[model samples]
Target chain A: MVYTSERHSHRGSRGRGSRGRRRRHPEPPRERTGGDIARGIVRGFGELLFTAGLLMLFFAAYEVYGKQFETDREQDQLAQGLEDQWEQQEVRGPDSEPLPGSANSRLYIPDLDLQWVVVNGVSQEDIRYSPGHYGDDAVSGGDATAAGQPGNYAVAGHRTPGIFWDLDLLENGDQIVVEDAENFYTYEVIEERTVTPDQVEVVDPDPFNAENNEDPQRSLLTLTTCAPRLNNTHRLIIHAELTDTRPKDEGMPENIADMAPETQAAAGE
Target chain B: MYGLIWRVLPGPWPVKLLLTLVLVAAVAAGLWFYVFPAIDPYMPFNDGAVEVEGG
Candidate 1:
């Protein structure tokens, strides 16, 4: 039955007797019928849709996987530059302004096994490859202070893989360590919440309380990223307060060293 | 569509195979470096920072 059906299809197009003869000389161009034209148009449209679907799949793959490699390289370079700056003891003074897009500090979320060199400004360009600190001008009528300062040290990063992809896993009481050239400021997570993109108050000195204009008595850290992983309709904010500050010469803080065995050994603990 | 291209190629089977590989690489490179980066800014994955209007 299969052979017969195959023969039927071949005979419908061109019979076996003429197949051999047609190979020597090309057939004359046949006039296209209305049905033939319609079929051609439908097939062309189908092919176009198939190509478009393939392109979209490729783009999604690049966004999820390919982009991670780029971020990894950029992070490595930034970390190296930061280390060199630290080695030279060129750390910026607390009163001196930081250069935009420059790597200023190292951020370590020991629970997440993540570390990134934080940049100076929170602009898109500044945070493209690394988490960026919110500068004083980030929000109108609001002041963003430096790390370990008695104000909000707000930082923002992309939700892509290798960055803040696992930010949602952070819970209250988690330890987040921010290291400047001179000291490591350990922050204890106080709250984790989601807010709308317009809620810039989350980065204010006193989050969610705009009326309180007085100086913040405690040094706080705010990490903002997109919520629900791949979506950006909301922002995920993690608020933490500085719990401990130790000189870099003293080695990694107890909380951070406890999380990593290699670091613990390196610290000679 | 690919079968059509294979039949229309002028060279022998090996040459056609090489040409197909080259064509695939070219398309992949174009998509990776140019098309993807060009459309990345419009994507929602990187819009993580909160911004107030006029702020």
Candidate 2:
């Protein structure tokens, strides 16, 4: 640690006398071994695993939150398309049928505080936009007339948050209303059942087959969704009988009074 | 780890800063285009089966 008296030592003048004035401490080395290399590899691998776990966390967050944005965007587009159709077309009556995949109606569940614009087909792509009308013979076709029809008017939706996520929470006697632009068809839940995914018979005209369609006495609403979120092991079915039908000109039904304002507004009251 | 990288780089301040920015942008692009998309299907949400009613 000797101090040099040469003022040129701090300058850029590199002569033999100035070389040793500010020399750094020499590092001890020459300890390379196979074990050290192996330890370094293992440490790097551990860091890689930690980074992988963080990536998985980000991916999970994206799957849960990111997909919601996509669904919401699709729903907004579908809703706008439906509004355009409603404005451009004539008022549909008891005899007219909405085209497949066309936006046809809305469903309001007061107990669950859920409202979704109903699309017309049950295909995966269709339900991705919104709850879809089941177009099997067991259920009525996707027509405006199907609202108050004397047979099963079945609908299917996903169990995700924006869709029928709380459907399994519906209890007997709960009100499920299906509405088009012109009419509101109210259905009171009579039964709830969880069946295997193959149980298409749940959507039959007479789910219990208590009577044939010759009489076609009851107007029914059958709502279905995949049961047990995160897995598709079974189907959750909610069966409701039509309780009332009111025209849009008459305003929203009384049951919709406690619903969100947007819901009430969507009802066009 | 990042400090080790900063110490190891040999350049002027501005050049080092530019290199750091480029590295960050490349990692972000890799995550956005490859890593995230590859792991999406394995996530637990929205994995419903794609089958018609009758089946």
Candidate 3:
């Protein structure tokens, strides 16, 4: 009886140990073949391409919509800052020169139903947030005059949806208004043309005669932006001559006041 | 690739999901604040202002 019981116990223990060993040890990994390696490489390359395509789409969307949001926010801040500056004494005078990158005046296009606070300089850093005024620092090497002065008041802005996107809609006789702390200067559009980027004479005091450095005989306003909206192959230029000047106390200019905000908003849409 | 990352991550499903969301947000912030602005000057649409030299 003892021998039979011992033999039965030994068989049971051996069976349990073998089962445990099998559970602990798994099968060896299979060696990779050339075809398997090639497949893996192709799959990785496809995933990389897919990721790149996604990134590009996101960037394009951000450029179109995200940039507009940034511009709108900056414009609001700049407009408020201009109003504050005007309230605190006088920010600009006939002889006083405002610092570069500073807000100088409010530009209003009644025809387009658009308005923006123009900054002093036209550098990329200066105009990134708002339309910028031309100065001696400009490529034209000519300084812009005061709002109603007898020289060119050149301005440059991006062709984004919030800024000069509809500048081409402006025609002859359209009014472009500039408002300083004191007066509203209205300019009537005289000419609209496209020119090469090198034609800096468009911003000169005398648009027709670049060599004449003397003070321009007439008060002129020049608006410039990139042509084709999406390309920088040329420049779009609009020339206007001052037609009327009135004190701010006299209320808004006639053309601007005639435009109903609701109508303009509908038209913009 | 995403599945591999998910499997390799050492956490519960909820923790892994939270970490994934954080990673996505960081990438978007980086593109919006740094990468996009840095490349803005090179884009044609942003080159609205005319200049005489290499504008």
Candidate 4:
């Protein structure tokens, strides 16, 4: 009887030990505690949240900085296109709009000594130092060079703190260019005019307001920005003439280096 | 009501993982389709026009 009871107790203890382990792990158990399940849920959720947060931060960073690398590469190409411009060929506006991009579509040089690029349209987003057209930078109802005439091709930019701030330093006879995918036109500064915001006619391509006026056909470029340094009431206009157009083939000259954000960073440093 | 809901929803760890994955995916999908393209949050626009030299 003693041997049988002892053996029975040993067997019972083994079963109890196995039961205790199952209680601790509790996989697919018939009954479970509220607390155990809650802990598991909490742990899983915390881990997921942590991973999601990390992924979001990564995506945001990529979206912001990715375009800068693109610009850095294209700057060299833009400079090359400028160099290849033909000496005798004159460039004009595109027959079609250029595809959306941040690189300058064409290169220009009115002075022949200085070359500048026309970012397809003035915008503040891609290039910080751009003469932007959208938002507060755009001077509305500005005259464009009429269909046949070319006198006015006026545009505007911000001056107080951003890219066009240097407009104040621009002098008469300065050159400006508006480039497209195919060709770039060069315009020479004829005069600098300061006018109120209401005076939108100044930017008109045909300021003369004549029908089919040949005078408007003259190659002209106008730059608009806020006037009087830190003031917004008046617009500072720089009027220029289309002196030359260069086709790609003549090749751009050497000595002109690309301006990159790194240049700006260096300036700040 | 909370206790009733909690009792109805068991399988705690597995459910949590699934919910977390769904939430994360939803956010990612929303950003991919709507926020990123519309806002263009990644681009930095700081340049003013620079004069390029030509022939």
Q: Each prediction's Cα lDDT score?
A: 0.78, 0.68, 0.77, 0.48
**For each candidate, what TM-score against the reference?**
0.81, 0.71, 0.78, 0.41
Best-first order by DockQ: 1, 3, 2, 4
Q: Please identify which of the two predictions, 1 or 4, would achieve the higher TM-score against the true structure.
A: 1
As a whole number from 0 to 100, the lDDT of residue A71 in candidate 2 is 62
State how far residue A234 of model 1 sits from its true place (Å).
0.9
Candidate 4 per-residue C-alpha lDDT over A2-97 given as tens digits, one digit per residue, 9 for 90 to 100: 976775555456453445545445344333445557766887788779877976685566444443333434454444443333221234343333
lDDT of 2 by residue, A1-269 (tens): 23342433433243334353345214221243344477678887887898789777766665566656656767666666666566544655434555677787778898887777788777655776588877643242222126678877888887766777778888999998887767888899999988887676666666667455444567888888878775678878889999898988888888976764776444343
List the pairs of residues colliding in candidate 1.
Answer: none
Q: Residue A79's C-alpha lDDT in candidate 1?
A: 67
| Candidate 3 stretches greater than 4 Å from native | A1-30, A84-93, A139-143, A211-213, A258-269, B10-22, B52-55
Which 10-residue span in candidate 2 chain B carries the lowest summed lDDT?
B46-55
Per-prediction DockQ? 0.46, 0.19, 0.40, 0.06
A1-269 in candidate 3: lDDT tens per residue?
89656655544454534353454334231334344477788988898899899888888877778788888778777776776556542635445656677777888998787888888888788788788888765635445577788878888988777888899999999999998888999999999999988888888887876666475688889999888887888888999999999998888777888654632343233
lDDT of 1 by residue, A165-191 (tens): 899999999999998878899999999
User: How much is A215 displaced in model 1, in angstroms?
Assistant: 1.3
C-alpha displacement of A6 in model 1, angstroms?
25
